[model samples]
Target chain A: MGEIVLSACGLSKKYGLSYALDDVSIEIERGQIFGLVGKNGAGKTTLMRVVCGQSTLFSGSVGLFGHSGKRGLAEARTRVGFMIEAPAFYPKLSARENLKIYCMKRGLPVSENLDGLLASVGLPGVGGKRYSEFSLGMKERLGLALAILGDPELLVLDEPTNGLDPIGISQVRELILRLNRERGVTVLISSHILKELSSVATHFGFIHNGRLIEQLSSKELHARCSDALSLTVDDVEKACAVLENICGCRNYKIFPHNTIRCYDGAVRPELLNRELNENGVGVSSLMREGKDLEAYFIGLLKEGRANAQLY
Target chain B: MLNYIKADLYRIMTRPTFYIWPLLLAALPAAMIAGAGGMYPAGVILAAIPALVYAAFCLMALILTEHTFREDMQLGLYKNDMAGGASRSAVYIAKLITGILLLALLWAVCSLSCIVSASYWLGGDSGLSLLKDMASLQAASLFLRVNVFLAVFQAISIVFKKTSALILVYIAISAAMAYAMKWLGAAWPGLAGFIKHIAGFGAYGNFGAAAGAPHAAGGVALLLAPAACIIVLAAIGSMMFEKKEF
Candidate 1:
């Protein structure tokens, strides 16, 4: 509702035999953390490149914030800061110097910008510290700082935390959240870490085979993945017999050891246990269960692949 | 665009390669003086005759500019910069400024050397007056023209995305033009008269033909011709770059 910051109309990029992106379309609302999830070679990077104008869109159109003309693309680019792949910098220059050069390149007001930008990324006091000396985590932070140099309204980060350690990854995750929540900046991010992605994304675009398999909000996904009742009993055989006899136990799964996962979305645990106890089965534990994103995602992917094979 | 141009000049001027070129060029005239010291006062007039000797020197600046282009692209710096609102023309002009700066550095070195080498001669300049000599002025002017020419060559070098090919083609064209100009100069004597005069290539012919009427004209003509071609070539290259898929 705030306004679409990025909208691609039939965006397609083909590399001869392989359709890198086939008629891909998505709209990103301003100030939203938009997640682009795809398998390897699913056109995530290619879509990003086309949107960034790094590579021209081979088919269809891209309009950035109501500005799609050449001048519009040019102006929109200034407002978009991207770290496409590995951060590029002069190996000889320090992180600060690289930022300074980037500032100069963009003609941004840089009186105190470099210091503030560096500190914002947790790279403080990196005055004469040459960029070559910085660790991968540090480099990724510096690259983020550079992307944020102009205080762009939108950030396009392609695997920002790709190769970072757990700590580094969390730090980047926090930084991204702060950028979006605190700064009110729209973000389009692509990564392999689905759990981390789900934590931040307000909307998701799941792509496969150069096409968007699905696009849904968190509430929508949560609702669609059938909820279940989970139970942990001391005697799995007893719970299985009790469940099989119950009216709603036909679809339940007896997990390894002493757990039975019930797929009946509306069945309450108290009622289920009371019915089981009345049937001469004692229960130790019972709780309602819901499908996790990973499970739901796998189901969707399998469904998509099955459909593709059919066609 | 102006900011990008300024930033590019700053980057080029600070580079060690930029300073190295002019110093190498400055040594050329001095070497000329050292080879034929006191043998001919006329040699003073003929001292800097082999202008094309430093063509290779200018080629070095072209190489550096091409290298900068390659580095910017490789470093993803170009991606970052272009991601901003900077125009492709701005980048092309930046290359021109870099080439000019390198040429300026060469001029400074040559001016210094011409003064020192001329000093050991009977009619050499002394102190601050060394740079004021007419031959030093000529060398400075030629160096300026060379920078402009190099800017164009460097810009075109990137258009083809290869430095060696453009440099080779550049040298081949220069040689071909020289030969063709001479052959044409004999037939109508005025066939390409306007082009040659515009180029000023015939102003100051090499010293062995130092006093020939064509030499002085060739020197002045060389002043503008290549530079003009460079400017035109740079413009074309800029358009190509803006439209080409980088």
Candidate 2:
């Protein structure tokens, strides 16, 4: 992994009687596309806001580019870009005019690489059109262009693809990939589209009820999601011995209640059942199961809920 | 800070309303002079200077309230400025400076128009001396009074972040205070006299005094009183803005 671009520790925020964020801690490394997944009101937006210095008054510390505290965070934020909730723009101004204002405010030379910036976001011919006339997707694209105005090292996007069409979605996905691969910009994105995120995210953090339930790399997630053959049998020691010695199958896990799960999908379930039966292992049930990212997320949330019930 | 000011200036200047409002205000003095049969005594025009100057200041305050403070906050321009790495205090100061500069521009246009109209129609150099004296005093007093209004409005804008509500509250409270002071002065002269000295607008009390006598000391106090209020109010406003979330 590269250097840690953002690290939030023990973040706790409350509004009135309820806590929006409850001791949430997260870290994003350079060049990584970290996906934050959570249900509505699960503190994903709150956490992102705090990290980007939008919402303050939280009880914790945030380190951006290895800098912490008010002064440090303000300095570090110069190198960070973000689009939170909805895009903000002057309704009366044209796209070019609005960008000109933004560039001037950022202390960049106005009109410097402006056309290219607009073109990069697929807004080449629409510079003269007022921002209020643009559609939702177009507004989102402009927002993205504004966020990347200074070529920020870190991009914090909240539901960037929310208002995009299918083609726009794919374009944004490719854009994110190209930015990460070519510019090495670290991205922190939150979305409800699991399949879309699964294709791009390098790491995943699942949040439930204002708490981070799980965090894992894409490789680890995939490894945990591999297809498995679940088997119920008597004499679990003999079943394991038969599977390893007789069938030459070593990738399997034994559970309580004399159950075993074999992870080698290449080996047929029938072959394993036959081998276990011929080895005098009494098999009660056998089933093949596979999980995708969405199913895995659901399973994790369920497990989190079950654990919560216990406490 | 310069970058923020530049951006704000661009935004303010591009709108037609910015130029249109000032032109309209400049026309008022010409219109008044024209309505008086295109000729009046120098004393009549000189006596009207204070009222016209006050009108200009009021218009400037309305513009600042509507254009700079309220519109920026409503459109999330302040957030955009902060997002671009501008310190909150810098943004606040930039807005103040930009508003003052624009108002000053408007004041110049209106004052020049009035002077030109008087010179063209009234046709007298005797009243010119008194006009010049009152004009300078009114200009100085107007600057201080406008700064006070802008500082107060800017502070309110930072705290409330809502333009329409703030303006409504400000106008309502100002009217109420004026009426209350008038009533108090009529009911108990001594009490009102004491209260007027410490009021926020107390600094401008010397405006009339300076107009009559044109004293250097009163003029200096006129400038310093608002300057002091601006510093204290701007500091408090800046601290509030710095701590504001979003």
Number of the top candidate by DockQ? 2
lDDT by residue (B41-117, candidate 1, tens digit) is 54454444345444554555566666456567545566666666566677766756655654555555665666666
Q: Identify the runs in model 1 with alpha carbons over 4 angstroms from their true place.
A: A225-227, A234-250, A255-258, A268-283, A287-298, B16-18, B44-53, B66-68, B112-149, B159-228, B243-246
- Cα lDDT for residue A36, model 2? 91
**Residue pairs with backbone atoms closer than 3 Å in model 2 (clashes):** none
- Per-residue lDDT over A165-192 for candidate 1, one digit per residue giving the tens place of the 0 to 100 score: 8977887788889988888889999888
Estimate candidate 1's alpha-carbon lDDT, on a 0 to 1 scale: 0.71
DockQ of each model against the real complex?
A: 0.54, 0.59
Which prediction has the highest lDDT against the true structure? 2
